[model samples]
Target: MGDLMHAVGYRKPLPVDDPESLVDAEVPVPTPAAHELLVRVEAISVNPADVKTRRQADPHGFRILGNDAAGVVVANGPNVSRFVVGDEVYYAGRIDRPGSAAGYQVVNENIVGHKPASIDFGDAAALPLTTITAWEILFDHFGLQPGDAGTLLVIGAAGGVGSMVLQLARARTRLTVLGTAGRGESQKWATEMGAHHIVDRHDLVDSVHAVAPDGVDYIVSPFSRGNIDNYAAVIRPFGHIAAIDEPTGLDLLPLKPKSVAWHWELMFTRPILLPEDPYQHELLEKTAKLVNAGKVRSTATTRLGPLNAETLRDAHARVESSATIGKVVVTR
Candidate 1:
């Protein structure tokens, strides 16, 4: 390994169309800390988080912005016990660290998982972030059990996290899954992922009621703004609602009558706040097993190109458009 590595970073936030939004440069290769692994990044997938970070956060200096990655461990800290050199791994790395938008990155071993053997690096890269988010929302936040039978409504069902939620709910639980999509292509994609019914985003309350009149037992929404009223109307008494988006002026008083439970899910919480938690790694391992068993499949629908400033910019633009049908991955 050399002292310097190729990387894509930005000194300041700019529009994706700007040529300097993400610039190619050489940065020093970072060394692994205790319980950390130095990985040679092979593939990366862009998520809304990446776009949001680029648009809103002040890096203060050149900062690499990527979270979902599949790579091979080239080195490890002295205290690392979960993996060794040359192990194929995947993870949604911590936001506080230098990210995967470079030739190599250092991620803690406790939050990493072995890549599914059945998929390539690009496909594997698409799973970690969405998989972690969906799994946490379903099992952790919603407190769902294996034999639980009810209706689960997924808003923005064709996107990365929703796709995984539909698949995991079908494969691991007895719940009837319903997905909302605004377009025909997205509706079809949601059905293919395992949604038993497709709800029109425009007529959320009516369409969701048409499929499950009793009301959905659980609702998971990636796009939560301006939809809380519909969610309140369709959620049954004592039902659960989980949202990943940050919506301003969100009024929860509408759900007071039903005693609806609300949850906020952020997959980075474990890595950023509770670094000692091993559940994220275990969850990823379980997800990898599901992928290997063919119960869950990769949602990488668009491959921009190799990992570089140009491809990363394109990937960010696609995600920021809010029309992506699935994940956009860039390979090394």
Candidate 2:
């Protein structure tokens, strides 16, 4: 096989409402570096990040805009002996790197993992980005005990990241997860995904009171575009809150009364901030093992075939619509 490969890309930023934003094109099949693994992408999933990047694409150069993918490692770099050819893997690749909407992609072995054995490629592709975000928030940032059960609140608990947070908390910890959703379907979906309780986000504080009454031990804000101020009102004293979305004009003052610790879970910060950390890879490997063991499941819904511009555009539209749950994936 030659080095050239097909990929989905955008030459310039366009509104998702516009038709020219995503395009099918050919790009170089990147060669893995000494610490990298070359993956042949069988499936790729979409997150809100894909939509954000698409809207803010740099016109000066072409941008391949995808982050989560499941594939097989076809080659390894010079010092990369951990994985060999033909290993099926899944990962939410680094943010600073070229994306996974392609036939082949090169990623650091540190960030990739073996796909879960219980599911197909499409489902596995949906997990990496969301699971990594949720895991890093509860485990790395808050230092929550995996077995220490507590009253946990997951705001916006019907989306991709929220669903993963629910499953992970249920699987690893005995925490009674109280997830927030506005609609009936989302509420049912959250409950099915392992939320011990589901409440409407409309009357959040009141709804939480009816469920936990004592207040939740931890709050995961997988959605933070709004309601931060309202959340602090109900957060337990000396509790922890972790958020993973864009903070638009948030008031940090409300958290002072509760002695609450607020954290931001940007999964990309690790690879972007400390790219050489071997411990991150160890964590990813462990998470993958859990997935393979059937302890947790993948979290995407839309699975279109082959990576391309049209598929990407459609995925972005769904994400922006806020109606899509789990992950929107493009599989080969």
Candidate 3:
């Protein structure tokens, strides 16, 4: 345990456009600091950020990257009382730090939550990153109050975060769920996940009209790999639009007349910067409670083998393909 542990890392950014980019290597096992928990990783989930990071990692150093992980505590830092050693936990660790694609990881106890009792480690692993993102985007950013009688639209409603958003909104809120997905498979996925109506993105406004007849009050789009201009048509007057994609330029001028609100959600914002509110972790624990009660199940559709470079790349590729609905996970 004293020696270095295994990790998935990159020596230099290479073309995922090619294949020689990511690598597996022995890396130092991090020691927990005050308020930190050193977790023995049991599972990890690959996200779009994983692929992006690999392709954009610093060429000068070994860049280790991953985001979502569920594991057990092996050690705890000083002043830590929220968890004891051997407690099973899950968290979408900070994106700025080295990742959970390793044997052990150092993460804050505040960001970590008790693993959902209903599911195993691999299934539990898929929920954290996407859950946090969907929760924040729908509730926090878009301000979709649970019973506002407002209609909520989830664009790209078949992917990981979108799927969770659909479930969470439908389960926790009274807002009518309108899911926008073009593919037949995506539409089926959305319907099964509790969407009131499924709309196509090609002609979003018309598709939305077929269901709402009026318009949606809240719209959330975590799928921004495409352009950002599409939401303007379906979004109602004074409605709110929330997204978690990159800061691509979208004309905000159109949204002004309706007093519409456009907000961005970055799940890592809280943990990466160590914001004043530590209670978000408490909220994630509450999510765990809902999941434990069997109101929700793991979104992970595919599970891979022990964490290694090849497996990590494959996970990343799965994420980047943007084909999988729900999460694709990796476990040891």
lDDT of each: 0.92, 0.82, 0.82
Q: Write the per-residue lDDT of candidate 2 for residues 1-332, one digit (tens) a residue.
A: 57688888788888876777888778888989998999999988888888888788574587777898888998899898568899888888886778898889999887777777778889888888888888888788878776987788998889888898888888888898998887788888888899988887878888898988888889988666667666776788998989887777777788898899989888888777777766556666777777778777777667786567776777788889998767787888
Global fold similarity of model 3 (TM-score) = 0.94
Provide the lDDT at 319 for model 1: 90
> Which candidate would rank higher by TM-score, 1 or 3?
1
The lDDT leader among the candidates is 1
RMSD of 3: 1.9
In model 1, the runs with Cα more than 4 Å from the true position are none
TM-score of 2: 0.95
Which of the predicted structures, 1 or 2, would earn the higher lDDT when compared with the native? 1
Better of 2 and 3 by TM-score: 2
Cα TM-score per model: 0.98, 0.95, 0.94
In angstroms, how far off is 77's CA in candidate 1? 0.4
Instruction: Point out the worst 10-residue segment of candidate 3 by lDDT.
Output: 223-232
Model 1 per-residue lDDT tens digits across residues 120-150: 9999999999999999999999988887889
Q: Look at candidate 2 and give me any clashing residue pairs.
A: 300-327
Clashing pairs in 3: 15-18
